[model samples]
Target chain A: MSGSDASATTLGEASERETLKRIFPRLPESRSTIVGPGDDAAVLAAPDGRYVVTTDMMVHGPDFRWAWSAPYDLGWKAAATNLSDVAAMGAVPTALVVAIAAPASTPVSDLEELADGLRDGCAALAPGCGVVGGDLSVSDTFTIAVTAFGDLEGRAPVLRSGARVGDVVAVSGMLGAAATGLRLLFSEAVDAAGEPDRARFERVLAAHPETVTAQLRPRPPIADGPLAAQAGATAMLDLSDGLALDARRVAEASGVGIDLDPGLLGDDVEIALTGGEDHGLFAAFPAGAGLPGGFRAIGVVVPGAGVLVGGRPFDERGGWDPYIGWDGHGG
Target chain B: MSGSDASATTLGEASERETLKRIFPRLPESRSTIVGPGDDAAVLAAPDGRYVVTTDMMVHGPDFRWAWSAPYDLGWKAAATNLSDVAAMGAVPTALVVAIAAPASTPVSDLEELADGLRDGCAALAPGCGVVGGDLSVSDTFTIAVTAFGDLEGRAPVLRSGARVGDVVAVSGMLGAAATGLRLLFSEAVDAAGEPDRARFERVLAAHPETVTAQLRPRPPIADGPLAAQAGATAMLDLSDGLALDARRVAEASGVGIDLDPGLLGDDVEIALTGGEDHGLFAAFPAGAGLPGGFRAIGVVVPGAGVLVGGRPFDERGGWDPYIGWDGHGG
Candidate 1:
């Protein structure tokens, strides 16, 4: 994305200090930031005495593609995904620290757009949260690692191992949409490179803006984390590794089997069950306990092992692992 | 670096879960880690009510060369560099979260050795602090981003902006040795690819194991951070960007000029001024506040601007900036 100012400088033409000066004002400021960027270390007040911390990294090739996303969307997706991890623990995200490693040839304008997206993402979804610190370096490829800190507000962290046998399995927000969107993006990329499927692909891309956004920059139900905690969620996690893999994780951790109902999940049950990158919340509520608004019950916990479908293990597998990149081919 | 085990598997041959499982047992376990690696997010207890946070990343080509470093050294360096940041804040580090992005061609056993380095580094330096969580992904260039958390134990952080004009500036440990070692490594890399300079190069390399270690895997004086704070250091920071540049930072932050003494630092004063990556403690103490062990007085703060030697700015410069890799060339 180009700026309105003519003759924008690329990051290659600037000094390290100059690059930092240009990006400083673009980051959102947070109230919890007692000592923001430009210090030996940042001091943030943890009023509740305890905080939750999680970190994730996105690489250029394995995590995303420039053809599929703009610098802004990349920044937004990075922030949103890390935010979802914190919210999964029943906490309010307070601060973010990002480390960006990019090739020197990258345009400085792109970094500015990335900064704007980071600020905008927090403002639109997790307000009051801001980027507190950053470290930049040169690398052969671009990679962003983000660590998010959140306040639990005296509540116990909702762990993945807290589910009981009688808990009702549910999900919050969109599911499988990101995976579907990813498939279309891959198809579009292939189409652009080879034979033209422009008309059909255009209809697919133009008709599903939400799906495109989901695959590119997902806005998970951040608020539902606290609501689930308040409603006594027995177990909780973000559906990043697809429902099947992540459900099995919670089950193994909590020592219970997840009995998923394909019929109850409506028509997109296949995607909901196996598609990853949804960034939606996966939680368990006691059998009779009330679920927060926007939550849909899709399964239940039973005394057994692994994730189940139709009261038995599925013959088909659903999930995306990084070893196999976007093409489902080994790296 | 390849492992001693001949049958070691490359990461391309393993799944993400399998890769993680192979490395999990090698990480050191921390008592503060209520939940360790393997979950969606590891849960850590912040018993002191507040924590000090800092992050740093090391890229392969720009930060270090595999020719000069082993996988063990790479892991150790990554952990040491970040631990130094937490200690710079006068906080004892408690936990570490690392996200590693590497190519598929990297060996799984190399990662295991990397994990061993991580655990050993923490055990040898910041005892009781251990690796808590990790996020693994595929990338073209291998990068390790480490975020370290520390407990302040109720003392207000000693910021870089707290130095007074009358304060005495002191530093702990060696300076410039790492830079000198880096030059040697570069020459060696160039020599290996070009004409031979074997005799002299071998002598230069073999004569300075400490310097080589400083460049490839530095174990800085981490304990000096709290010792400085206990000695009533008013302003503090670690020397990563050379003495001149970093001194200017503290000077600008505290609004005070610094007058350094070349003679006071003894014979290695030139290296002391321009050499960085020493990871030594640079602290400003109220004049005659009784300096701690190993910390030598090197300069004094004065009312002016920037850094000065003999009341004049030095003609030489030494430092590392990402935009310009080792040669300080932008892009």
Candidate 2:
């Protein structure tokens, strides 16, 4: 493909404009963004009239290894990770800033491919939100940092706190795909060991295509966050940590108890409870309110002190913990 | 000092609370910011408007090193570096998002100290801005990336291509203190090769205290950028690359020549001509207009190519250049 072509042959085939086209339609409208994307600096209305912002860093070797992912995939994943934080707060994403550090020997084509992926990632979730400003520095290793902005749109922001007894619990995206994909990519089981051999790795990839994609490129449920807020979501958060752990955060924050139904989780119990990097919306709503579109009913708020799964304490064997590295049941 | 009490220090002090306080003043009065700095996510005014944004990264050992400065100094310098880019395009800085990556063994106090310095740096310039969100990740070394946002106040942004011949050149803020200070810091003439020579360094430090401070903490003339716009600056840019090199950018952008008067620079010849990191405003105004306050006549526009200093070609000498290492002068 030519340099400017929009083909998907090699990762470099896509251009920034092509990526933007794919992602822009998904974002909701917001008034605070006077000039959304495509500029030196984005102009926000700050109508409430203030702006809330934050940033996060992802380094290649420390954060992710190239052996398991491509540069474009890395770019998309990085953007999604930061944007998910913005979406978690019941806010509308407005703009994103990116800083990339890479070895000078890195191919310019790879850089362009990364930009294409970033444009696609942002547009897919926040439409019309382009990287407005950035700094490119040379380093020995590849590192990316993204700063994200959001607008509250005149509604009270739903925080980790505010979950209460009798509240219905819901989630707006899939679970465990990322963790499963990661295991397939990193585990020795896929390398030279295990009963099934290398062919099993291909079987895993074929069986869970969506899960593999989820690990490569997370799509933050940007629109559902605001919709949930409009539907009176009492408490909300992005499920970056496993559902069980993140739910514990909400329970602790609101000073309440959470009881999750393992039966409701279906056959993928481990994925539902301990899978992370879902970028899915997990929220608590008033009992009578209808669950918004795209959300699955998962559990209920209760008057207790901690998180429970199937009427038992959800321990590490059945949950996710960043420190211990997400070894749960069935994995 | 106690945390809350120390929070009162300016954002330049690099403390957590001060980061919030500095941003509080600049935020537009809006109800959307329900849970601002102290929360996991800040509520904002996203009222049907789109948002624009960008991000940049600075890595220690590559972008900077501790042997050259303190943690707080690094904090201040990092914030200033990104803020300059936002202000360069005639935008009002609003919010900042930061991500820091460091070794697991890195001291938490050092991180706090860095935060204090970042707070102080932002407060010194771009007051009323606050750090809204961030993520801390472990890496082999220290790195900081910042994403900054600005409001355009609904005007078409002034770009680099608006200059015309016969326009006069003006500058706001100092010229070369940073470059000079850097020279003093790394030279064997100022200190013995391996001895802990505080006294020797102090003499060098005292001789050009402003320059040393400028290198450690750059204060971009952000207010003057808008003033230049209002004063009808034909073309403008922040002096990041050395003046001569930066002049070439404006010249290439506008297709005009910049003729500088070295004799006009007062008492700091080396800094006036080749120094970098001044973060001063360099603008082109129509000839015969009285220059604005805080601005001084340094050059004039002509109808030709590139830049000239004292009727000769202006050789590029100072500024941060990637190829020649941090302290080397590049031609």
Candidate 3:
């Protein structure tokens, strides 16, 4: 990301109070927020008797590189991913508490843009949800940990362990674009020595805006999550660790099996099946109950174990595990 | 701080799934948990219409060092600090979503102990409050970000902006011990070259268990928060920053000044006034209202704009701001 603002000052040059003054105004407040930032704790309304909560962390090197993502993209992606988890539980997002740690040398403008992205992301994906509280600190590596809260709105949470045999499995949102964009960034946006090059990344992003944007700032089908639940989704989860792996999770949790039709997946079925970071909703519904408007049927629950594609067992690792997959390289 | 488990394995040597399997059992569950870990999001009961929420982060170098703190201490401190924020709001802590990122070389056993600490801390400080969800990731530095949720139980939130000039200032839990412990750790528990020494840390800890333990694992009077609120506290805040700074915060927020009696502060009044990380409850109550059992009078709200000690303006730079205070040395 370019830090070209003439007034840019690194966090190290400013006190925490000064840095907060610069960024706080850009943050959005939710209707549910009774008390917003600047307090010891924020008070949020949860009209229902219950709330849904989840947390996710994105680390600098293992999650994204500055060479490939801007501060805005980082903030938006962080919000999107965690909001998806809340939505996956068939809840409407209400508030977020974000904690960020970055190197002292990071430019203050970058943090402002990050706050803007967090504001805009909540505005776009979950209209009534916004940042309620946050903490900022210094670290050698930049990291964001967002804890998202959602209101159940008097509805039962959709769980992955509710799928039953003879149910139809459907998915909402794009499947393989993010993973494909990641592949492209890794393969084409690097210099001769394999270090990510910002200039080349811009070119690649321009060449594949749809895919690259999906990877950088995903627009998951946030509304469709509650829609699926209202339509009586028996089992549901957000597609994060690839279709095959996530589908298998539902299968194992529900004590059933999933058999997907490859033909239902768009071209490059392999990528759609085993690629990750889709942030889409994958759900199961009663066979006759019709899929939600944004959902497309891709499989069916069967009385067996594991996942299958075209009636055959499908297992191709199916996802990325940072602990085992990271190659110890930022790029 | 010892990684003495013979069966210890580095995060990089195990898959995320295997590591979670070891940790899930150690995490505590709250009675309000409708759905705990293993789901897209945990569903927690928020019986009241509103919930108090807060987040805090601890970074490896700036917030802690392995040479001085164990994984257990890190986890305990992380939970204690965040939980204190919830309590400060006059709410009962209900759940926490913790996200952690550590070096690939960190031992799995250390993480297990960290989990135990999280479980035990919640069990000890705020009974029935427990870890409901969390995220694990890889980073060059060990970082922990915890977001705590609390139920107000129908009481109006006691805000920092609610104090009046005639209110009496009171406090629960010890002040300055944690900061004093930090000073001792830095000065006495370091090698000749100024790097933290594990042996020296152990020796210093043995020599001054009260202060050292206070720094590593604070036991803030969590219950006294709601007790003070029920006793008609007009305002309250947790003392994370020093007494003077935090008192100034409450004073500015409430448009009043705080006059503290130095005689009430124990010996070493300077440290008691300026040292940070106390995590005690500082509150304001009506002048004639009886103080809660655990709380004792320390000051009075005055008709001014800052903090006063012994009836005079107190302006020593009280408190630590990581951005300015961190000297780029882990020790």
Ranking by lDDT: 3, 1, 2
Tell me how each candidate scores on DockQ against the true complex.
0.60, 0.30, 0.87
Stretches off by above 4 angstroms in model 3 are A1-6, A329-331, B1-6, B329-331
Q: Which segments of model 1 are wrong by more than 4 Å?
A: A1-7, A192-204, A325-331, B1-7, B192-204, B315-317, B325-331
* lDDT head-to-head 1 vs 3, winner: 3
Judged by DockQ cut-offs, the docking class of candidate 2 is: acceptable
Q: State each candidate's chain A TM-score.
A: 0.92, 0.80, 0.97
Candidate closest to the true structure, highest TM-score: 3
Candidate 2 TM-score versus the reference: 0.80
In terms of TM-score, how similar is model 3 to the real structure?
0.98
- Candidate 1 accuracy as lDDT: 0.82
The residue-by-residue lDDT of candidate 2 on B1-331, one tens digit each, is 3446643332223333334344344422222334655444665433333232445677765566565557788888877866776666666565666777665445455666787787888778877555666666655546788776555555455566778999988888778767777667667323344432446656766777787788777787877766677677887777876677677778878998889998777677656667777778778888887677577888888888888887677766445454234221111
Candidate 3 per-residue lDDT, tens place, A58-98, comes to: 99988999999999999899999999999999999888888
Output the lDDT of residue A268, model 1: 81
How far off is residue A112 in model 3, in Å? 0.3
Question: Alpha-carbon error at B275 in model 3, in Å?
Answer: 0.6
